[model samples]
Target: MTQSDFDDGNEDDVPEWADRVMADVAREVRRRRKEMKWTAQKLADRCEEIGYPIPRNVIANMESGRRAVLPLVEVMVLAKALYTHPLRLIYPVGYVEEVQQLPLTYPVDTAKAMRWFAGLNENYQADHRMLHHHIAHASALERALFAVQGEERQRWAAERAIDDTARAKALRTQADFAERAARAKDELCQVRSAIAADGEPLPDLPDTLADVDPAEGYERDTD
Candidate 1:
């Protein structure tokens, strides 16, 4: 078997958990390939058509548990070629249920929140930072109100009270941007998910587009 390099550690010897995961992947790949009645070469050809080339022997080795590491990009391309979601390849059936059943420190939305942050514009991010800074200042001031003498505490509290109006205005603007960003992300996911479902039947054409080439326009009513 030809050697494959893994980023986790020594390329020659892989960890047990990774090996187990790869074993599951190997089994899933083999199962899906058989379900589609496709030869390894055919799968390879499809992958190449999509710009990721996987040779037949490599596919064989991967299925036979000879390959130590499957690159992430290859797994995604393989899932694309095999006509299924990448999650189905990496995780077992009922995996979503299993994950939801486990206790966690943070909400699952945290990952999506990070992605939303990453996609923010520089101006929007600056606004976000400024809002956060203002919030921190308000919070610190509010806390100091409890620790100070009578007038000093009142003064600290008054400062936060004075900023409340401006803070609310800034937050409203950020909220608008955040809502639009979320809607755009959801729309993007829906479209890409439709593309990933390559084996499924296409959606029916819209009423206006049914039965005619767009360039020719709708067939004129002919008696």
Candidate 2:
């Protein structure tokens, strides 16, 4: 019987924790593949269709724990082929309670680990430099715009509502989203001002936000 690479290696010769995580990933891959009712050949076909071909035997080895390494690129391409997010396969946020995210650290809350992996951890973002903060604030404004647009869609849907109460509720949601957009625009202006104060060139606002006065608090010269 051929032993798994990890099983044959000395403790110091292998990263046991990493191999264990790979085993977990192997299980997940098999599970998702089976759930989709796809054969290994079918999965390989999908990988090729998506422009990265992991041979059927290679995928079989990965699923059987015979493959010692899973490359980052393969992980990404496999994710695209499997119709799932790479992070979901890597950490499995809601499916597991905890995960050992690093070599030496204790197991972390799975959701927290996933968030950190995805660069969504608030504490990590808090330590970013001013330019990152500026980008984040700009993203917030864009998200607010999307939120308002979604609310507008709901309001439009309310036009087809048979009940006055449903229509009123949708209108209220639109109003609330509009208020949030206004706040986001104000925050964006502040971010631009701070960037200008720091001697950085302000980025152009999105066309939807063109009406916002980015230089609102700065004094202008009157010749």
Candidate 3:
């Protein structure tokens, strides 16, 4: 599978629309960085301390709108360093939402979910990222498997074609969870009462979802 050709260019080379988006990103990043009272060097150090390495100059260039190729990973790590959601870096001003959505079993309180997300720190974000990927890297298989019966339809456009190496690599986490979820029958099915009441042990799992790990990937409901 070939890698996606992400657009990356300097302000001079990027088109006006692209430049405006970059400037918006820069302003938000700068605003968040300043809100935390963190210097560019501090952000660099923090990023390196975890795993990824980004230099101060890179941060400076990004904040100054000189750097155009803002890797999604960079945005994630930078957001962690700034103690804010990654969406804060890219979404328009005065907007508020979880950097990403949490995949709960059922009956999730949307407000509570937002609060739970807001409370997460860098420590939690790594696992959270593992639980859900940026919308850009989600697979069609994942997108289909994630939703439940009769919820309003979510945005389907974020479902990406394959070849997301970094994200797909991280997607390997917790195969057992997928196994369990796949084996779980619909609780509300009318005919399911006989099977459930029979108290028969679950049969061996189907091969379809064998390697699927729900945590590592799922499409977002909205932008």
Candidate 4:
């Protein structure tokens, strides 16, 4: 279905690209609603239950592409009701390869667009690169923790084999991963402090790293 299918008699006033995005939104809404086995009425009920209260007919109009205007609030509420992030509905990264970030701009990679939208791409916001570093370190920390667990299991299996060579190799690998994990955790804490010093809101730490004190890094620097 195209944007014309949802024309509300004011197409000239709105940009064609904007209309296309709204059409995509409508398509996604219908696709996700059906994917979840929800009827229009059921979706409406959910909207009401969640305090937003989009009517059944309004949802129908959107699904059919007859409703051209979609407010940001509606996008947010619809996403919440559908159990997804607003960016997922707007960008549909896996469903589409590329999307136009703005009117008149060439379409870019969907994943890149999603990152820009979430302010997680340093290229998009050159002045604030710390956010990107924080996320990168957090990602590294999680992967290192997973690696530590895998190496520990391998070490245990090697011990059960009663082979000194295998046991030594496994122990070495486990120690390497443990050191990587410790380095990642310390970097993450230090980055968290830097981000906070810049007057940005601190990102939430993972449960495993929640007790790490960012201030400890500061105190060490002072010493």
RMSD of each: 23.1, 7.0, 20.7, 6.6
- For each candidate, the alpha-carbon lDDT, in order, equals 0.55, 0.74, 0.50, 0.73
Candidate 4 residues 6-41, lDDT tens each? 334444534877877887777788888999999999
For candidate 1, write residues 1-223 as lDDT tens digits.
1112233443434354467557666777888999899999999998999899999898999999889789888888999999887767765353222211112212223223333434444455355644444444344333333222333434444456558776565555555544544444344334323333333322333342232123433233233
Sort by lDDT, best first.
Answer: 2, 4, 1, 3
* TM-score for predicted model 1 compared with the true structure: 0.39
TM-score of each: 0.39, 0.62, 0.39, 0.56
lDDT (Cα, tens digit) per residue for candidate 3, span 15-122: 544554456567778877787788989889999987899999999998887786787788788878777777566553353322212112222333444445465544
Worst 10 residues of 3 by lDDT: 149-158
**Which candidate's lDDT is highest?**
2
Error of 1 at 200 (Å): 37
Best by TM-score: 2
Per-residue lDDT for 28-88 in model 2, tens only? 6888899899999999999999998999999999999999999989888888888998887
Deviation (Å) of 139 in candidate 1: 33
Off by over 4 Å in 4: 1-14, 122-126, 130-189, 192-223
